[model samples]
Target: MSDAVPLLPFVRRDRAMRWAVGIGAGWLAAFVVLLVIAQIHPSTAIVDLPYLVPIVVAVGLSFAAAWKTSGRTRIAWVLFAVSNLLWLIGEVIWVFYTYVFQRGPPAVSVADFFYLSSYVLAVPAILVAIGSSGHLRHIRGLLDAGLLALGVGTIGWQVAIAPSLPHAPRLADAVAFAYPLFGVATVTLLAAVGLAGRHRLPAWAGLVGAGFAVAGVTDAVYAYTIAKQNIDSNWINIGWQVEAVLLGLGAVAAIRRPEPETRQRDRVRDLTAVPLVIAAMSAAGLILADRLDGGPITGGTLAILLALFAGVLARQLLIIRDRTRLATQLRAALREQERLAITDGLTGVYNRRFFQEMLRIEAERADRADSPLSVILLDLDEFKKVNDGYGHPAGDTVLAQIADRIRGSVRAADIVARYGGEEFGCLLPGVDEEVAIEIAEQIRQSIGRLEVAVGQGRSVKLTSSLGVATAGTRGGHSLDDPDGLVNEADSALYRAKATGRNRVVAAGMLVDPVYADPDLPIGLVWLADRIDAQISVHEHSTAVSRWSLLVAERLGLDMAALRRVGAAGRLHDIGKVMVADSVLRKALPLTAREWEDLRRHPDESARLLTELGGRPDLAAVAAAHHEWFDGTGYPRGLAGAQIPIEARVIAVTDAWAAMLADRPFAPTLTVDEARVEIERGRGTQFDPAVADAFLALVTAGMIGALAEPARA
Candidate 1:
């Protein structure tokens, strides 16, 4: 009833309600006039016409309400129309008996059947209207409705039904008793709905409830009068006319535009509870009265009580179940939200935030236990090419696959995370430098083997560069700071990219620039300056110096010879500073004249080192780095042993670095391709002995060790 209030300006609502009241008053006045005329004339024609006219008008108004309302309200309106139509049919039959047959209708006749059926339709119509109004979802509301109905029905039965039941025939008595009981049930249910709703009850709903109440009281009076043989009364007809007019007014009120209802929870303090308690007390009193009369409780009475109890219990159980289900669903929703917060949306791996927290925790634990903790930072080589050439979708596919492989490759104790775009981080607790490097190498090789399908029939091979850094090593960077440890690993990663792709570089092998001696020989210091000028170069001179020492030692060179070889390797590309930046940064292949100008770098390096008072042996070796073993190379074309062994070693290491390192002029080559190139030039461009020593070091896995920073 509360849900049916029209949402309009206050002034408008007041005017509308006043208009409705006026119409209702006018209709009542007309009824009074017809009733007076009937009493004066006492003609069947006058009685039938006045009685039928108001009822027909009520039915028409109900149909109009049904047509105007929408959604669930329309259904309620239609049911109201049906009930009014049924009432009209009952009245027409009564008129027929009076005018055509010239006799009164029987008490339990077809007219009574139609009248009873109207109650049947009207009761559900009111209930549906309340239910569809969104006020009955609470368990308290249902309980309130049931309790009120039980109490009201009991009171009505005692007052109206018991007294007249013994005087009438069994069938007629049953029909008369059922009418008031049905009316009580309908009125109680409607009142409960009104009380349970948070908003004010609608005027139309109240009028409808009033109509039902009037009709129920009228039925009770008519029955009692009939049983007492005093039923031919104008007052009974007046009651019927009032009920019809009330129903008609209710139907007209239904067309008012409904207000937007403010929803609230029903409280226990509502006055509806008082009536329920009083009705219960009344029913108990009746039972006591029956006991005092020595009337044993019948099976029907017991059955009714048990049925009511079962209904209350069922409603309670359903409420409990619904609450439990809602709690479980809420818990699951929270867990899913937490998971989404920590996981990468594209790859489903731990994202940067989670990884950072985990790394900090692991670092603290490792520092406390004096255990090794390592981090491996990996970046996909040429990832931008995948995005540019194959499209972002293909790039995404490659990223997901790479993350999957990293997860599968690492041990369960290790944490793998997507650190950022094209970069991944792994935290390995209780892993040392050697083991971390081994794991990183495995990741590098595995990524190299990946052939991701971009689209069409085309596939692209992918590769990665990894850097390994361990904490808790003597004389190494501190592990107590997680950010410092990560920076160390990132530095090693930068070196890996600088020296070559598709390989792993260890933090222990990274050069400490702060510790570099300022008083170094002029040539080496000058070489460092030249290397710093290049944008694409990354610690290449340092890598070459380290590789040269490794190769010279492997070939059994003496300490003095090794020193010269290492110096020459470090200064090998120092003359590149003298070359034009345009030629150095060119993307296309160099022209023949540009190549000729490039060929003079070796001689220029020798001249600069010699003038700077560097070792003559180192300078001579740098000058002949391009001299071939077959005498088909460089400025002098010196072949075989004719080329200095130091120069030959530098040439092999320099070529390897150039092949592995990224350059604007050419794509980087894999380690296997570099090895093949080195092998192919063994006799023609490389000293056989130096080349053999280098390949032996590779076979023995010493090259990977040399790729790391020199341990203190």
Candidate 2:
């Protein structure tokens, strides 16, 4: 595949392909240019034929590199590499024999063909330093420049000198102009391309293209000397030798140098017009000084002043615009931050701080203008007990619905805030006692009729208690008082709560302060007991959850992240409330139908927790608890880790728990017996890691809670 393994330290398949493509493209381009060189030197058969063997090596390497790396990438690109190598071969034959043995002095012979043809191998050596990307990056532009420059040079030189002699070779006629013009155009183009890009490869390629720089200079000197018929012209070979050195320099620079990072920065700087600015300034200054055209002294001075002023103004304008844009951006950001500060994220209501601030504004306004303003106080009944019973998620839903209903009933100008817990406050602008009471009643009734759903088909019928108070001007003096009004409204609210919630009461000029009673941790000890109870749950739940986790861990998932799987796994069977205890504890064989119905624990567990304010992510895991790694084991036959990791862990743990716990249908097994059962199930039903961990736990005396103590 490699033709031979590259012994060069830098050799690889990539370098091989790059060299092949570059040589193929370069030579093919050279041939097209050589056609122009041929025309200019029709009689000079050799025309020095500078580029040949490089073509054949390209073709040869294309085949070799393609074979070497074909298996790693697409076969077609590899084949393309082979084609490049073959093209190199064609360039070799044309360079030496046909032209060298023909005539035109320099003592050339056809015998030098093989000796010259061997020079193509130097390319692969270059590939040792620079890789494939360098070749492909440069070759196209190099070929194009060579063709265009050679074509132009041929035409220019032939036209300039061909008219002098009828039988003279075009090379003698065209060499003076042909060599220099073509050389300059090609080298300059390569330099331009190299300087334009950011990638090191392009710049390197450009520099390599400029490698022909010295060759062009030598040809120019030689043509001039030969045409002059100078006898000692051969002594000028010393200067011409410099051209060969430049060629080698270009090749070495292209091969040894890495891709340039400056290419991109240079282009961006160009686009920025920094140079253009300098050029414009220089031209303006020169013109003002009367360098290009005649001008009155007075007018020249004015123009110079105007030009300097304009440049300074433009620079200042750009700086000012950038600063202004930054300031506007910062202002907008602050406005958004302020807006978020006042709004409740969950229910989109005015929060406590904003509501209080707005109330102060409206109350002061009402007092000054001799206008009426009323305030309403409200609280949802049994809010805390509902949270404790159904879970906090359900409590949040109840609060959200209460806010929605109150919002619908209040005036557009009214301000509302969550006072605390289930309590809320509303400030009514331009409304008196009667209107406030009506609004408060409407809100109370609306909330009373509302139904917010929890898990399963269960829904909560929400109700709230409301209190209303109003203040207005009396005898041209504003009779408004914020603290007094709030207190009266609160007293009325307490009255409603006292008389079985879901009703509203008017303050009716009463202004006694109302103190809210404290509600403590309420059931802290009960919660503690609940937490302690879970230790037993963990033991039984571990039978399936741990096993499922082990299987999932050994199967593929990271063992560390298995906490989600483990937590879900541990709680997998919490839904047994729906399964009859009779069925769970039955000793005899279950009918096929009973077994079918018993597998519904995961679904029931998920539903149960959802009602209990469980996290949605945890609920989802519990729902799929019975699922197994293999599609064969489940209510839904999912295979190959298709089951949730949590479900798999829980499934294994559930099995372990059932085996160890006393059972009517089967004798309870000790930890060791349970471990054996799991090991027998590896790959079939249990995960290997799960079985091993369980056995290890038993063996390491970690089975204190797992095994019953023998009686003395």
Candidate 3:
């Protein structure tokens, strides 16, 4: 019972709708019978008095609908009520003359005045209800309505008005002319509402339009019959009865529909075919009439055809103009989207992605032209202090001012971009090292002189460290890599920060040989030191290097091979710099995701070796150090001899060092326990030959304890 209670109101509404429809249907049937009877019996006593009841009911429904609505809808309903009441008054007068005096009214009586006035009020009523669909849409709707109405008016002129013109009296003829004119206007208003936009009107709106259109057309036909002196076929009274019932139904529908908070607006439809269809039908009907009558071309018919041609041309022109405006707007929107994608939002400079892309392009240009290219990387010194001391807003002001100063100091051809955080990069094409250094020094000095306001009587001074690098010969060899140029500049920037807070350093001043005999390259050395200093991985790395050399020597490897193995062991885990320190130092066993991240170091180690040192051999050794002999390892699963000899050699030593060390995730094993573990995994985890050599070295006491020696 509780579940069904909420649905009771809806059920009642449905029942009421069914009753209203049934009553309307029965009333229309009775009116049709009356129309037939009055036609069959010429002197029937029935007149407009019986029709008065339906009009009165229509007036009540209209006022009730008005009371239930608000805004423009309410005004429209009130107008409908007034229009219906006016028609009712006219009908009453017609009944009085027909029954009391026992004779019909004159051709143009006070009844016609009330009837025409009701149609006039309906014009504004339809406009008020349907004109809410924006200005452009409404105007277009008017043009469409005018075009269609012209066709209907032309047909009416050819059929009715032209035939009976000479016989009718002047005042009666004027009244006859007024009916079709009012019919044209009323039909045009209804058409405008119907064809306005893609959105369908409410059921009430359709019924109202249909009611008015039927009445208007019927009145036009009545005028024709009167002009012909043929009043016997008053079967046309059926249209008035239908109009009454439809208007009443329209009013009831209006009361049932809930008014929305805002009126629904519609976009103009691209309905080109509607105009063509109307034009074709109008032209075809005129042609058929001309054929049937065997008549010459009339002036009235020719005028309507010309007017339709002009309307079609005007509609086509409007469509072209609208499409052109939309196309231009689309292009402008696309341009804005492209600009946003390539620009930094805060600093209003080219962003990091664009900077990297243009760097490669500039490098290619320099290579083809054989001209120098330079890059300068600048980092703001103590930028965090500005943010911490004066809040982020002041820091932003400082960054923007700093970027402006940098832009002002650089050449017009140079591209300035925000690399990330407090660092900005400048790419200079066709410029040598000397000019690049000069530009960097200028930028540093400009930044030092600038002071940005935080707020209210307080200002913060700024300073920046800049590093400049040019694509040219370094240590008697060509150093033309774009990434190498950026890396050199980045190294120089590090030196500038280390030496002093605000200074400029050039890559040429910090030269190291491209090839180091037994030592790592200068860039690789710096990278190794950074790894050790940042994560405290030096002890394990150093021990691994020493143990790898011993194992390699025991396996009959020469000095060059031993050195390569030792270097691979030291740098194999260098890629661990990217892993978080918390993961590296976790006291508990690492999660699978953390271990997966930890395993990426070998591949990164190889990439760094190849890019920075230009040594693919060392990279190969570093990349494959973790591969198992049985093909169950991360990154790449190169088993047995497929793994590099140096990597295989280092794998044994790396494991030995890890096992002996007091690592967060592993228990430190004593010498015998470590030996047992190594022997146990000789064929599976480690290469049997490499493991045998390592075990041999340990047994002979040539290698010391696996861990680093304790400090005194």
List the lowest-lDDT window of 10 residues for candidate 3.
1-10
Clashes of each: 11, 39, 0
lDDT of 1 at 649: 91
Write down the worst ten-residue block by lDDT for model 1: 510-519
Cα lDDT tens digits for candidate 1, 1-712: 3444442333256776567667777877877776688788876565566777767878998899889877666777799899989989988998888878888787578998888888788876876665424333444445555555565655555665555556535777667666766666666666666665544545666677788888877776776675566755665776777788788777777776543233345566665444446455655756775687798976655655565566556645654676576689899999989989988989988898998999889988988998889999999887898888878999899899999889887898888999989999999998888678768877776676677777898887776878888888776557778888899899888877764455677776632121222223655555554663472544466556667776887788876776677666767777776788788878998999899888898988887777764546667888999998899999888888778888889888888877777778878888889899999999888888889999876665545421321111
What's the CA RMSD for each of the models?
9.4, 25.7, 20.8
- Pitting candidate 1 against candidate 3, the one with the higher TM-score is 1
Arranged by lDDT, best first? 3, 1, 2
lDDT of 3 by residue, 1-712 (tens): 0111112243256666567777988987887777777767655466355677788999999999989988878988889889888888888888878888788788789988988788777776776676544555555555666676667666776676767667534786667667666666677756655554444456677777788789778878887887777877757887888888889877877787634422444557645456557766887788788778888866756777778888777766765665676699899999888988988888888899999889989888887887888899999887888888888988788788888998998878889999989999999888787577668777876776777888988887767878888885344114357887899899888876764346566775521112213457656655664665554432566556656765775677876786687677667777777788888778888899999999898988898888877777789998999998888876799899998888888888888877776666677888899999989988888999999988886765544443221111
Lowest-lDDT window of 10 residues in candidate 2?
511-520
> Residues 522-618, candidate 2, lDDT per residue (tens digit)?
1321332242243332235433432444345445666344555645554556666566666766778888877876787667767755666344566
Q: Mind sharing the TM-score for model 3?
A: 0.50
lDDT on C-alpha atoms for all candidate structures: 0.72, 0.52, 0.74
